[model samples]
Target: MFKTIKNDLPASIVVFFVALPLCLGIALASGAPLFSGLIAGIVGGIVVGAMSGSNIGVSGPAAGLAAIVLVAINSLGYQNFLVAVVLGGIIQLVFGALRLGIIGYFFPSSVIKGMLTGIGIIIILKQIPYFFGMDKNPQGDFAFLQVDGKNTITELLNAINALISGNISVGATVIALIAMAILILWSNVLSKKGKIFQLVQGPLVAVVVGIIFYVVTQGGSMNLESSHLVSVPVPDSFDSFKSQFNFPNFGALGNMEVWITGFTIALVASLETLLCVEATDKLDPHKNVTPTNRELFAQGTGNIVSGMIGGLPITQVIVRSSANIQSGGVSKMSAIIHGFFLLISVIVIPKLLNMIPLSVLAAVLFIVGFKLAKPSTFKSMFSLGWKQWVPFMVTILGIVFVDLLWGIFLGLVVGILIIMIKSYQNSHFLHKEGEDVDDGRIKMTLAEEVTFFNKGAILKELDNIPADSFLELDVTKTRYLDNDIIEILEDFGLKARERNVTVKLISERGIEENPKSYIEFFKREIKRKYPA
Candidate 1:
């Protein structure tokens, strides 16, 4: 891992930058303290990332769980919510131990693709407010309008009006534009020139330029008080840092609300983690498979640790994981080092960090979001056929219009319905035989695995057979014959006797004499001697 430090370090930095705002934003959305996000990030990076089996995936506070977290916290209170988070972690550990991690595998590929594209579109939509300096609403909510002040569409309109009103700062605009330019140039132009440039990612360069631009625009040193800046929480000293730790109220664990919240968190966070792990693996350059069980264990541990320290629960997050992989992270060490950076930076130079500007972070997120919603995503989904495309399109629309879980459920239902319809259609009867049985000779053939649905067709053919004809019924290749079909055959046998037709049972299961009833032949010997 150390041998690739040159590459990994830069990648880690990119992931770190990308992760910073998300942690805060998700925490805010979850109704948790701002510092809670930082704590989750620290634990996810250092603890969960270290324990995780995935090389490229990054674990952190997930936007997917924000709604659940918000509801859980609101009902249970912060202290009780903390206990639930810890309990949720314990439940995840149990899930992993029971080998239930394979649940992630059952999702259809089309649904998964839809999920990725939906999330990408969501990230872009959610971050638009931050990009243009609108911070009234939290970032995770999918509603068109926000509980805070505006809906996504309405807020977007507001942002546009604000832009026209010149509410955006010139300094912020300059830094953001410079960062975006640097990223675009580095990725599209400089990256193709040489191995050296390729090794340095666009996001990393954008970050450096952002900082430099902040300095240049200010004409001096970084200062939160005087310039556009990041807002890292201030912990005055070692004692102050220690004071920040928060413990869950064990006494509240017995409350019904607490348990309900725990179950909710466990379900949502685990699903989100599983989905992200799968998605991130798809994006991994090495095509490495992440151990889903281990990922659950690691996330469980991280959430437990984080909750104990006043942090939000964590999960395998695609945004950070993709950034980590795209930045060239090769191992868990890059993730771990990035966590350490977050931990130390808060204590060492928070004021400097605070000067970094939200616009800079917005620019980075903007790029990440665009990559997810690219036109290629649509083309790929369209190629998968109606069986897949229906569910995929439904899921995307559900997420865009409703919520994530709701969208997934709607898609799943449609997928299941489609499968059932296909099954019903495929179960139809088929016939094969000579044009007709001439000269008082009758012959009929049954298709493989005759079901009750085929009984109707069999009866129709049997009714047509002439009286006083020599009949032959062939079921040689048939593996399974339904009870209803057997009943139909038995009834037909009685009619054949009156018609003077001699019925021949030509089947893999040995034929029986026409002297007995069809029902009797079907159940002959009761469980004793029968045709092989």
Candidate 2:
């Protein structure tokens, strides 16, 4: 997994860029100490990444949970909230131990696709302001509107208004355009010619250009303000760095409200983490399947560590994960490297990081969104038929209009409805090749696996079989038959007897004539076939 340093190294830098602003902004939005967010980012990247099964996923302070954190802080106090975070981590560990991670598998593929597309659109919408040098919303915000009461489209229009009103910073705009140009050139043109371009990525060059532009425009009319850039809390000395870390209050351990808050954090964090795992796996070019249970365990540990030392709860976040993938990350090492970057950069170059313009990072995320929500993706999904398309579109709309979890829930509901309708209509399990034989023979082929869902269909098919029909019930290809379905088939044997129908069970045991029940028939058939 660590073999692709050429790829992972540059990807780490891109994710670092994406993670920096988000960490501080989420911390700000959560009403927590600013340094706490960096702590979460570091723990999420190194601790969680090292333990996680995800190859491309990067964890950190999530924007989705910011509102919850803020409310908890306001109600319970910051120190008390930290105790809840620690308890939340413990709850997550319990969830992992109980193997509750299997819940992630229940979501339909269509819903998951919709989620990715919806998030992509949201990312594009959120970054539009920053792209035009507007700073009303934070960088990684996914909501249609913001805490400031402006919607995505309105904010987008505001960005355009700013552009029209001559509010654009020349330095930021120039660097942003150049950054995107260099990115396109590096990916399409330069990387193909030599190995040098592959080692050093476009985002790094973009950051360098942004820093230079900031220095050059410092005293000019076009100078960008501090608000238009990253803002990690600057520590003056070792004492300052030590002062940043805050421990959870033990006195809050006995509070009932703290337990409730911890449970809320655990539930929300787990859901977000699972969704991100699914989305990140889909985004991966290699299609590596992450161990969902292990991910929960890793995240729980991360939250415990982060909460213990003045940080917000950690979850696998899509924005950072997508940035890592778009930047050519091949393994978890990129995520781990990014954590170190967060740690070292804060200690060494907090001011330098603040110099890099929001527009430049916005350009990087814009590319990520483009890759996720390509028009071709929509076309391909639409081509898969309405059974798939309806749920996918609904999920996208719900996510765009509503929040993430609500949108996914709506899509899942639709997807399940489609499945039920299809299952009801597809009750004909017996595939009859020809009409009938001279002996009044009719063959019914069983599906590969018969489940309880097919019980109604099987009953209907059995109830309508013609009288005196010599039915050859084939289970040769069947693997596992559900108990409910077996009962249905067993009851059908009595019906077959009353109708004077000859039931020949054709299975791995060769054949049986007029068996008593499906269960007895299966037992005899197995005994004869295995013959141990």
Candidate 3:
């Protein structure tokens, strides 16, 4: 891990900057204490990072869980909610032990790509309001419908109206534009000139410049308001900092509602984490595959630790993980070190951090968003044909129009439907008119793996066979057949007798003329494989 310290250190700083505002914002969105978000971030980075198999994935309090956390906190009380979080973590550990991580692999690549692209679009859209200094909505809220009672489009329109009516802060716009310019220049030009430029990242430089701008323009018409800056909780002293931590209420353990909430958190957090892990692995330059089960265990541990103290539920977050990757993170050290930075900054330099403008961070996120949803990505997916493109587009639209989980769910549904359609189409190979044998027999070859999905297609073909016709049932290449298809074949055999149809069954075992019973044949085959 230390071998990549040079890369990890700079990346950690970048991730720290990216994570700080998000941590506070997510906590605020969840109606939890702002410090709790930082606590989750710290634990996610240090504790989970240490245990996680991922070299680049980062975990923390996610915006996706903000609504659930808010409701949970309101219904259960803060202390009881913490109990749920701890229990949720325990459930995640059980998930890991059961090797449920295989669930991540089931998500189609197109859906995963769509997820990344959709999130990128969201990050860009969400930041637009902040870019224009409309700070009514929390930065961490990524859902289409926001806590502020406006959707992304309406919020954006409102920001534009504010700009037109001269109600928006000119200071924020100016800072954001400057930050974007600096980032563009740094990435395209300056970073190429020297190692020094590479070592000192553009986002950090932009943030520093934003702070300087904030200080210089104070009391002027162009000065940004406190609302436009990062808002980390400022504890007065050690005692105050110590007081920020809230312990979970053990008394709530017996509540059935608490258990339900715990399971909900565990399910949602695990899904989000697994999805982010897949997306992060795709984003990794090294293309490293994170062990999903280990990731669940690590996340569960982090959440447990975080809940025992004062913190929100945790999951592997794409924004931070992508930020880490974009900033050249090569090891888990970057994630761990970023946790340390979150810890140290909240204690030491929170006041300084508060001076940095959200507009500048918005500018930073703009670049990240663009990288994820590049126009080239769209063209590439389209070129892959409708099979991949349909789900990909659906996911993007769903994510942009709905929410993260909903978008993924829609895409997954579409992906599965596409698979079913393809399976139906490819279920068998039928001999063309001229290809039939001289004996006027019709040949139908079953696919390698015929599941229940192919039952309808197979049945339709069988039903169309002419009376007194010769039919060839070929299972030469079939490795597995569903019982549904077996039943359909058996029924067809009975129908063949009525129609006076001659049927030939071809298999690896031997050719048969009208099998007596499909189940009996399979039973005999099983016995052939394992003789007494």
Candidate 4:
């Protein structure tokens, strides 16, 4: 882990910057104390990062859970909500133990790519307003319909209006533009020239410059307001800092509502974490595959620690994970160090951190977003043909127009439909041409796996067989034969006699001429394999 400290340290700083506003913003969106979000971020980074198998994946308070947390908090009260969070973590541990992490692999590759692209688009679109200092909504709100009663488009329009009316913050705009410029220059040119440039990342430089700009222009017309800056909870003293931590109400453990809320958090947080794990693995330059069960266990542990000390739910978030990967993080040390940075900074230089402009961070995210959803990605997916392209496009659009989970769900549905269509079309191979047709004989070979989904296609082809013909039903290579298909074959076999169609059933078990019962043949084969 220490082998890549040089890379991990610098990447950790970038992830810290990327995670800071999100921690606060998600807490605000969830209607919890802003400090709670920081607590989750700290625990997610430290505890989860230490335990997680993912080298580049980062965990923190998720925007996807903001709505659920919001409702859960209101219904259960803040203390009770903490209890739910703790319970949720326990549930996640159970999930890990059950080896349910395999669920992540079940998602199609196209849907996963779509998710990454969709999130990329979302990050870009959502940050535009903040980049211009039009902070009408929380920075962490990723939902299409926001808590502010406006959607993504409406917010963009409002930002445009603000820009046109000169209502936007000129300082923020200037800072963001400069920061973006610095990032591009550093990535494209400066970083390549020297080891020093690589050591000192562009995001770190941009943030420092943003802070300097804020300090230099203090009290001037170009000055950014408190809303345009990073807002870390500054503790006046040790006692106040300790007071910020809220303990979960153990008394709420027996409440049915608390259990339900806990289960909900566990389910949602696990799904989001698994999805992010898949996305993060794809994003990792090292091509490392994170152990999903370990990730679940780590997340569950993080949530428990976070909740016990007053924090929102935690999950492996794509935004922070992608930022870590993009920033050159090479190991889990980066994630762990970033958590420490969150811990130490809030304890030490929080006021100084508060001086950094949000727009500069927005600029940082802009680059991250573009990397994830480059135009080349869309073209590549399109070139893969419609089977891959349709689901990918649907996921991207769904994420942009709806929300994260819904978009992936839509993409998965489309992907499954495509799979079914392919399965229907490729259920069987008919050898009807040349000698087979010329001799009034036809050969129908079953696919490797014939399920109920292939019933229609097989039935159609069976019905098309002409009368007084020789029909050879071949299952020699079929690994799995669905009961429904077997029944269809049986019915066809019985009716073929009326059409004077001589039927021959072929399998590895040998051929049956005019078989009386298909079910009995399979039953006999099964008994042969496992005798009583």
What tens-digit string does per-residue lDDT give for candidate 2 at 274-323?
98898889889999999999999999999999999989999999889998
Clashing pairs in 3: none
lDDT of each: 0.75, 0.85, 0.90, 0.90
Q: For every model shown, what is its TM-score relative to the native structure?
A: 0.83, 0.84, 0.95, 0.96
RMSD of each: 5.0, 4.1, 2.3, 2.0
Best by TM-score: 4
lDDT (Cα, 0-100) at 335 in candidate 4:
96
lDDT, candidate 3, 425-502, per-residue tens: 773544334235566578888767778988778888889888878877777777777778777876777788888888
Candidate 1 C-alpha lDDT tens digits along 368-443: 7778778887877777679888998888878776767777777878887886665444533444355353677655
Report the C-alpha lDDT of model 4 over 238-355, residue by residue, as the tens digit: 9999999999999997899999999999999999999999999998878999999999999999999999999999999999999999989999999999999999999999999989
Error of 2 at 188 (Å): 1.6
TM-score of 3: 0.95
Badly placed stretches (over 4 Å) of model 2 are 1-4, 160-171, 236-241, 286-288, 427-448, 455-532
Candidate 3 lDDT trough over 10 residues, lowest sum: 427-436
Task: Name the candidate, 2 or 3, with the larger TM-score value.
Answer: 3
- Provide the global lDDT of candidate 1 against the true structure: 0.75
